[model samples]
Target chain A: MSHGYQAVGWSPFKKRYDLVLGGLLAGYLALFSLATLLLRPEITAETLLIRAFGTAALLLLHAVLAIGPLARLDGRFLPLLYNRRHLGVTMFLAALVHGALATFQFHALGDAPPLVSLLASNTRLDSLSQFPFQQLGLAALLILFLMAATSHDFWLAQLTAPVWKALHMGVYLAYALIVAHVALGALQDERSPLLAGALGAGVVAIAGLHLAAGRREAALDRERRAAGADGFVEVCGVDEIAEGRARVVTLGGERVAVFRYEGRLSALSNVCRHQNGPLGEGRIVDGCVTCPWHGYQYLPASGASPPPFSERVPTFRVRVVDRRVFVDPRPLPAGTPVAPAVVSESGGGG
Target chain B: MTPLDVATWIVRLAGAYAAAGLLFALLFLFVLRGVDRIDPSARAGSRGFRWIVLPGVAALWPLLLRRWLAGASEPPEESNAHRRAAAGGRG
Candidate 1:
């Protein structure tokens, strides 16, 4: 809750977070520069900066990508997810510096403009061994610049969350571009096993984390599908859903959150409207289903945000028979009001 | 035209577009209403927020225009009880 945005809604926590980040970044650059100067004294200062910033940006990008899956796997990593936009912006700046230095070093003072020079300097598009890796890097940088520019809440609001999310998914494309950029550009020039191994490990770590998290989510979906039948899916017994908690069931390829609150059962789409957050993982706060990711709330019965907030999610029809909860797999339109099923006195204790 | 000239022209055009976009974004921030729907905490007259989001709006103006034209910023209406009943409402 901000009533008005400042440059940033900085808190003590953010200040400390930024300070630690800056310290680590400065330390990495310094160590990298020192090592380069000592070990490879023949390397030019410009080359040194390029390599240092490029590697730093690559590492930061890895950290940025890792934070999402890490937070999903462990709650302790949620703090990193909170201020991730800042991390992304910083990574872009580092990448920008690397791009600037590289362009100046390689393409400046030529007959053609730097952009033209970059494109034409190496037209070896036909061969993988001699591919124009700089162009790949430039493409990735453009994507980063776009993402960095829009890494703000205002854009999220302006573009709508779904559209904004889809746009940012371009990061994956940018990441692939960068991997090719490195493999065909820097790694080709320098045949260092250590550098190649680090890049491979980073790719493996990112891929492995995403796979693990996806498998976990898939297993939950499998369990739900195995228990249900036909269009009406049997979720669980009323007693299984604790008061103010929910049991998430996957029906018809979508996750539905069946929540029990005040001895009433209601089901709504599991995806949070704000960031596609898991609503089932969140508890009902103030008579609304609050997303654990950003605390955006929606009324369980109507799937509407409380007055003054405009977000909504699809609601599902739920009924209780002999303490077993059954949900209609077909979803009603977002914000559709559905009646809550009242729990019988003999059903379960709240 | 040679490949070099074509590439140079493309770069120049891109630069011009970026400059025009920045100007348009500034105008949109100052002149338009109902543009800032994502952050309720953002004050309508906050120059700080405007400056922060200017670059993003410039880069993504087309997407923003589509959203604005589609009336995506408007708040969702509360469904009436009769309408809810028609949709198979339990309540």
Candidate 2:
């Protein structure tokens, strides 16, 4: 972190990552173009550009969407998550090329402007098979453009992390629109079933990965939830929590991070105020609970960021009895200071 | 009015909005010193940074304006209690 903004804080690793990504994208386009030329020599240059770029963009989008779930399911995929914004921006550029070429070829030099033609050319909105597919594609491109444009830390910080995240969730809407665009437009004309089958498979793969990850997280939550007496829920034993770390427990539908630090225990909402990051997944650094995604820090007991930073998360009352940790289900307001439960000498042997 | 006329009007209005947005982004970058809102590591004031975020600022000026006005205020309270209770308190 510096005092001012640079174009990018590119590290050796990030540079390497971009190099690999560029090589892969270039190789894919070249191979796809060469294959198409040999296979369909009669095809016009415009059609070839449209098909090649469109397919590449679609594939890149699928890869981008899959990255989050894939990273969650396996630690090995975490490296891909580091520079995902670059990949997204590249994908948007590909989509832009495809859209521009398609518009010029089909809609330019006509009586109406391209945007108007895109919307009005196919007025068959009522027909499912012949719906105005160009409109769907245009709408999807707009969303992608918005996302790509804001894919920087400046926007993330200015918009605040939560608002920024919510805005970027427009990716899902874009994905749906693109799916409809392809199903109604290209699939209607193409004789081959390969493209259609691939689209179906891509959707299924993305959905299946998310479902599996959700199930795994749910199961972990179930295992951690054990109700104690008097509205208190048993998180793990004190022994289960590592020093400077936390045991995340889901009780009454709320995720709480029960931290063990300096012979004291405190429970706070697991969500980071900065980005809704999993605070429980992070460890205490410099005497504060550091968020793993971004280095936003908060005191364990108060759930408040250190002085001069106003961010806060909800705090919960926690108790330790006979080596076991129990947390009150009700959460206090953000920045509320609850007393930390000291670890007794007898129970602190772990 | 004919459908063509309506279409032409819509296109013209969209163009006007885009031009206004570009102007706003430039104002924010230079006059407002909006680059400070960016993370410190990225606040290098590089030409590349301006080039990259220009399109985003143009597209999302309304949202950015709201945030800039809010100015370090506490985050809006989340109403996830119902969902948390439904999920058995697992957020």
Residues A1-350 of candidate 1 have per-residue lDDT tens digits of 22355667687878888998999999999999999999999999999999999999999999999998998899788788778888899999999999999999999999887888997778788998899999999999999998989877665655555666888888889999999999998898786698899999999999999999889888887864443445577778888899999998777566789999988989988877665678998899989898887678999999999877767778888888888898887778788899998897675422
DockQ for every prediction shown: 0.33, 0.32
Q: Candidate 1 chain A vs. true chain A: TM-score?
A: 0.88
Give the lowest summed-lDDT range of ten residues in model 1 chain A: A223-232
**Candidate 2's residue-wise lDDT over A141-258, tens digit each?**
9999989988876665666566778988899899999999999999999899999999999999988998998898888677655465677887778888999999987765667888
Q: List per-prediction Cα lDDT, in the order shown.
A: 0.81, 0.80
Regions of model 1 farther than 4 Å from truth: A1-12, A222-232, A344-350, B31-45, B65-91
Tens digits of lDDT, candidate 2, B16-60: 888888887887676775544533333455767877788888877
How high is each candidate's interface RMSD, in Å? 6.7, 6.1
